[model samples]
Target chain A: MTALPPPSAKKLGLVIDLDTCVGCHACVVSCKEWNSQSPLGAPLADLDAYGAAPEGTFLNRVHSFEVTREAGPPVVVHFPKSCLHCEDAPCVTVCPTGASYKRAEDGIVLVNEDICIGCGLCAWACPYGAREMDGAERVMKKCTLCVDRIYNETLPEPDRVPACVKSCPAGARHFGDLGDEDSAVSRLVAEREGFALMPDQGTKPVNRYLPPRPRDALPEFDVLAPYLEPVTEGAGGFLGWLDRTLGKI
Target chain B: MHPAPSLILFTVLSGLGFGLMVWLGFGALVPLGWVGFVFWALAYGLAGGGLLAATFHLGHPERAWRALSQWRTSWLSREGVLSIVTFAVMAPHAAGSVFLDRPLPVLGALGGGLALLTVFSTAMIYAQLRSVPRWHHWTTPAVFMLAALAGGGLLAGQVAAAGPLFALLAVALALHWHMGDRRFAAGPDTAESATGLGRIGKVRLLAPPHTGRNYLLREMVHVVGRKHAARLRLIALAAGAVVPAVLLVALPAGHLLGALAVLLHLAGMLAARWLFFAEAEHVVGLYYGRR
Candidate 1:
């Protein structure tokens, strides 16, 4: 079962727009909240909760980086990372126990906790650091793409998406069948020029991140100009004479 | 990358155990009756003890049996299966040597071959991990095999064979170290590619995903001081290969000296194994601005 099933035609994935994300951590909060209560996945473990050191397992995380461009001021990019649901997910193939597997139907990767020995090889195999070992349950946990919600007949159509996507205030997170070129998410990816993280790894991640748009440059200004401007423009002042002499020279 | 004690012991002890079995299977110093039983006991003790240590590293040891079911794809599973097969095939020979004072040459050779394959499978567990560039090279398995041969030779009291085997191990270890130091930097992975934001210029982690350390950082990101590591490498080489090889070739084979050599070799192997896990740099660390 660890051997990957043949590639599925319907590649369900997410596209995140970096230009709009505010690094609010709302998705992180909502993810923890929903997954803890949802019947689909096991509860995320938080050891030493309400204590000095609270370590827990989370399916998704947001990391912010300061990027300095050659032409503009440095900008901060907030990167939200989770299971990319790669076409050749290394985590699945490396699993000693067949607990980790990928769905043949939609290409979604998942972990069957019942058979997992928690050897932690799947986590080590992952280049993206997407898998986490639960502190209390001691089982491998990952972003299931909200398998329970994505196809639940009981939920409303709008609520079928993953919790993080549904709760994102900036609308940075978008999800749909990326295999379909005409799908809205696919079109959005094309328009924004979305890219895969660590393409060199060859996992062929299904998810994409839209790079930040170019910023409009502001006019150059000096803080001390006002104080120096009045003196320089004046009436027989030393600075005025100096400027005039330099101009004449 | 945390250099867990259980794993270090597992690899070192098992490597020595299986290595001795190879020489013994080939009919070297085939002690009969009680002596044979004692020799086999030591080999089984080290190998079985190391295997037990490895299980302690698992989160669910009770479910460890499931690991054997996925041998088709997983190296870890292959190691499990091979270990079982090697032990089973080697059983009759071990029993015959101890109980009947006889050497079952055919069964012994097959088990010995399987034992070597099992060691190779164990090494592949680390070698196959592309995520950790330091352990991804062919040299990784080569080093493991060299160490096993030399250690096994010494443990089996094959002094004639020990000199050359230890020499090869020393050379391989040095070459592996030289290659491993440059692997990550030479490879395509970098902080820029990891985040896919390098087109802008330089990308650095301005704010981390969380304030507290997570499992990834704890398990994968570990660094050892350059001076300390260098000192340990020299010590490992001297104690593991040079000294033992010297003692075997230059001095008379006496009980006290042989015991001392084995102990020194064990200490060296332990240091080397610890460095193996500690020095490995996982690519995931790039996201955290770490090596």
Candidate 2:
């Protein structure tokens, strides 16, 4: 009789700090570079290269938005969007084939690309729109959480991290064993408030975003600078020009 | 959600195939005895083949057996189990019709019920997917029932010698038409409400997340023009239901007209099934820049 493998502990996940992110897009580039050469096959690409509409492949994208505050300067929120690897992954369940499966040990959702027929049902099932079908390969592709790099035994212990986390210039991205209660990510979750995007769907996304700090402390003069610039320019220019032309001390 | 051509063909073709089987099998049950047994076998075989062909659309046909394991939670599993049961019932029924001296009416009735149940299970598979709001309605089951009733009725009218059965088929055609009309009328309002932003306000996509078209847009945002859909619906209703009804009424004069009606009804049913998928709007459509 064959013996079954021992059941593993809880699945580890990620918690990103959106508050400190400066939208450098280094994480996006790093994610593409790492996944492109992985065993899972490349999902990103450069399309219409050397043309007017050239674009490159990216698994993660940083989006910048200006949120107008009531009493301060507009807060610029930088959002990094990628797969959350939810517990109730619709993408996996809706698959007619067993190509998509959530890891029993880590809860990291992965695709067995070899078995995928590229029928695209998994893409439809995802509300977050995380999975993208590689038009060239004719298979669905998504963020793998840098599984290969994170677990590689050949690499030095300190260097063993997701490419996105390593490349984040602003220290916005953090990767650790979220399943462990005393891990850095878990402690960060406890110290700061974190929220999942579209929590109403109840997919139980693993990734979390720390809210941007309030902009109330900024000076009122700085807030009014853009609106008051024209009025100040008219007065200052005329007075300065008159003084300059007359050679007044 | 990205309507695979193979799947669309499978569902529509099988709907007609199984629908025809139900009518023929039921005919064999009611007083007709062994007269319509050959037609019943043909219908069952066609429906079985259509259902089997649908499995080709799956990624792993080897794992297809596993689908039957989840009948407790999945309608898809129920459909698979019911389809197999239908086939099992059909084999014995077909063997009896061809080989046995005496027709087994009880077996015929049981087979007929199983065939109908198979179709119901297939319909319920779609009807139960709450994520696809358009499919999760009474209309889904109603349409499947209508397809079976109409197709079966048309087949029965063609093969059976009994004139009263033709009148019964006429009633089924009328009911199919009525239900089809009602189904189409219950349009995209539920979808609008599900988004939680629209009652009477105009909502439009100002900017999409990306310039390149992705799977979500391709799958959910398929739009058919209203004018064309309306025209097709009318044609299908007339050819599938009204024309068949007229033929059934005229069957007393000549059986050839009944045969013509069956062909017309099949064509109409195919068109109607096409429109069924074409007109359906998934709630995911809202995310794909459609309101």
What TM-score, over all chains together, does every model reach?
A: 0.94, 0.71
Candidate 1 docking band: high
- Give Cα-based local distance difference scores for all models: 0.89, 0.63
Interface RMSD of each: 0.7, 7.5
Candidate number with greatest TM-score: 1
lDDT per residue (tens digit) for residues B1-291 in model 2: 444556666666676667666654554433233554666555766676666777776645555675565454445666778878777776665666656744566666676788788888888766655445556677677667766666665565543432334344344434544564544235443322322223223334333445665555565666745348778777777776666666665556455776677778767766666665666555555444452
| lDDT tens per residue, model 1, A93-121 | 99999999999999999999989998899
Expressed as tens digits, the lDDT of each residue in A87-164 for candidate 2 is 766666655456677777777778777766665656655655577777566667888888887889988887688889
- Count clashing residue pairs per candidate: 0, 2
Instruction: Point to the candidate with the largest lDDT.
Output: 1
Residue B198 in model 1: lDDT: 92
